[model samples]
Target: MKKLAVIAVLILLAMPSNGLFNFHRKAIHFNVSHEKYVPPFLFWRWNERNVVIEYFDIVRNNDSIAANITAYLAIPPSLPNQEIMDIEFEPEPDKILEDEYGQKVACYKLKLAPNESLEIGWRIQAKIYNIRYILLPFLVGDYIPPDIKEKYTRDGEMYKIHDPYIQQIVRSIAANETNLLIKAIKLHDYVIRHLSYALDNKWDDAPTVLKRGNGSCSEYCFAYIALCRAAGIPAKYKGGTYLAELPPYNDSIFHRMVLIYLPNYGWIPVDMTFDEWIFHHYAFGFHSNRFFALMTGGGASQYLNWTYNSHYESVAKLDIDSTARWLEWK
Candidate 1:
């Protein structure tokens, strides 16, 4: 395992292409380098009660022959407003690992016999807080700290940070603009005005959305990330299920949001589409009274793959839901 890890690192270092790489994609750009900045100490605070995430997965083997499968479950981290105090998993995760995206994840590998059913449970105990707008850093370092640089600043396949077209747009937006915060705000504004929110089932690369001028949450996130990266800013994404208790469409649904690194304040949430839809009243720097993060970063989750697999659909099924029934919101 150590040897494999070493080889992977070496491959990354030796690869001719510049910027973040998506193992699943086969595109690369040359001369890609990352940049950084600092933001003002502007922020607000909110509070959260009992916030919890749970998953009930049932796998059935309808095939005439037995089969084996591997799956992973995201273990919510203690982030911004959500603070996890406990975790419970039946037949507990086989083991956990820091995935390619740099987020810690729990994995479960199982085998089922023909005509058999396998059940799994995952739960978390936690409280949520509201620190919507990020403020000056509690921990400060050089312009863009290594910790932040490693995860958020780097590019991903979806971000397409090195795409020539994306680089041009970001450069045009930041022209003669030296202030980091202002640049980010400007980019946010640009995205709001440029793209119309049209839901797309598949994730689109940043350049594609920018050209098409319309896309859903993933598109918004991808476009924002591309712009940030082009301007030498650190950016990243978070995927989870947010309480769809708001206007327009009010039904439980899965969602995605972006986070950009600002000196001093660190990573700040940017829900561009949601913010604009509400005319920037809520969201943007912060979103939601309740958000259940299933995973973050740009990559695929093994568990998600299981659900997307056509073969698996005929043989198994997955069920997941999160709520805050334990905590008193009133």
Candidate 2:
């Protein structure tokens, strides 16, 4: 983590290409300095709730030969806005490992004979809070640390930040905006205005989604993230389950949201899909207290990578029965 030394100012400079004789002027220039005016408050009063995430997973072998199975499950992580109260696992996993993206995953190993099954269940108690930041346009950090910029701004398979189409869109939408916060807001709103919620079997990247003009929730996030990155803003995805009902709920649907790195504010949550359901409002710096985050800082594959494999020539199947409910609320 990079630390500031006594209110230091960082400037972003674009270097020239090869050839010493031909010097090029910097195309991108920005400065990070102290805010001119201080607001009464920077963050709004947060609303909180307590909930429990419970799930059961079953892996079965249908072959005539014995086989070994390995599985990975995401552990509910603690964030600045969300806390993990407690966790209970039935037949505990073998080990817990952190993935490259910083998501905690519980690894389970099982050996089953022919026509046998293994069951893994767990319950996680968490306290989640709604995040609402009163962001000032100038106060939003224009300078992203080199490490974060490198990690988050890179174009991915589904995050086509470098695509000409995406770059063109971002330049048109936010090219003239000097304020990082406003630029990010413009990109976020553009995604919402252009893309309508629609179910699609194929997962499309930013350019594809933008061209279609409509996509699923994850597509909305992909498009927004790509635009933000192209505009020199650091952004990533976070996946989790949305706690929307009382206990005894059973549904396989999962939700994903974008996390944009704001200089002084840190990573802020943005959920356009959830916001659209609520009368098409802007959810740039606000998140409902109903999320059970599983992974952060990666594309959709980070969460969907869970699998069951076997060495023998045997067929295996996975089934999950999951439910989340309010444990305590105020």
Candidate 3:
């Protein structure tokens, strides 16, 4: 009897749950919406690598007077595409505060004597993920959240979205385009074709770029973003240092790009300058992990976009020198 019972138990364990001992076993069926569908083949296609960024600023009191300096250093934030693994400061900031955009601002206050200098900076270790979303133009829905549109499309300091000239340009370029993705691409191409790459000392704004017909990388980004926003496409600024292994490192050399929000794909990077310069052909709707993105939104300050913010009050002349550079960390 015992032997027969053991054999029965073994048979029960070996049998499929639905075949013999089925108890509350239910079949599961996943109904994925087309808007949020990710193909199985592309689901796991993500590459990750680490990079290090060193941003430093030097404040020198040149005149025969003392000065009080308040420096607000921008610390890179963790985003969906990149993660801050670790951070180290040269001599630790006096205090750290979070800006409205969730970017960390390290505040340093110092009293520098005449001919004295102060250097403040931070080294950030970040892991950047190269995850390219295969965007199907037909699959991109045209619905943006009301709040997103309200926040991104509104007129800001440099982004003159509601300006008459900007509206006219938007109408001419993307007015007839129904697909949001297609409209964005048209605007990107228009900026690339309309503007010439030239470094200017004047104000960097959308209308100025359109009128002058020449601007640097930041101008290209501004022009494209303004057009997109005017056409009711939510877009924002992305500022960072391009990580390249050539010509050494210089603090003054940084890059700017634009990120437009797609209904299904979220934020997609659009690099018109890169496309124009042939650094990355067909760069729209695609972004590589070759740069360190420091800031995502703009218009928080009058003279600063996505970089560090500094304010100093002194009775003497102050000369501030800043440098930002990055390299891949092994």
lDDT by residue for model 1 over 1-330, one digit each (tens)?
353344334524433332223343223112212424333333443444575555555667666676666666566666765767888877787887666655666667777777777776566677755445532222223377666566565666777778888878877888677656667766887888889989755767889998999988878888998898778678877876655443222223466788887665656788887777775424555646566565566434334431111113233443333222222221
Ranked by lDDT, the better of candidates 1 and 2 is: 2
What TM-score fits each model?
0.71, 0.78, 0.79
Point out where model 2 deviates above 4 Å: 1-41, 62-67, 112-115, 279-281, 300-330
Model 1 residue 321 lDDT score: 37
Worst 10 residues of 2 by lDDT: 6-15
* Off by more than 4 A, model 3: 1-47, 246-248, 279-281, 302-317, 327-330
Candidate 1 residues lying further than 4 Å off, grouped into runs, are 1-42, 60-65, 100-102, 114-117, 134-142, 245-252, 298-330
TM-score of 2: 0.78
CA error at residue 184 for candidate 2, angstroms: 0.7
Candidate structures ordered by TM-score, highest first: 3, 2, 1
For model 3, what is the error of residue 78's alpha carbon versus the real structure, in angstroms, after optimal superposition?
A: 1.9
| TM-score pick, better of 1 and 2 | 2
Quick one: best lDDT, which candidate?
3
Model 2, 1-330: lDDT tens digits are 021211111110111122112234111123334534344444432445777667666666676777767666777779866889898877898987766667777777778887677777677787877555555555665566788888888878888788899989988998988777777777877888888899865678889998999887778888988898889888988877776665555535677789998876778788888667754334656666766676675553343442111111224543334443335444
RMSD, one per candidate, in order: 14.2, 12.5, 14.2
Worst ten in a row by lDDT for model 3? 38-47
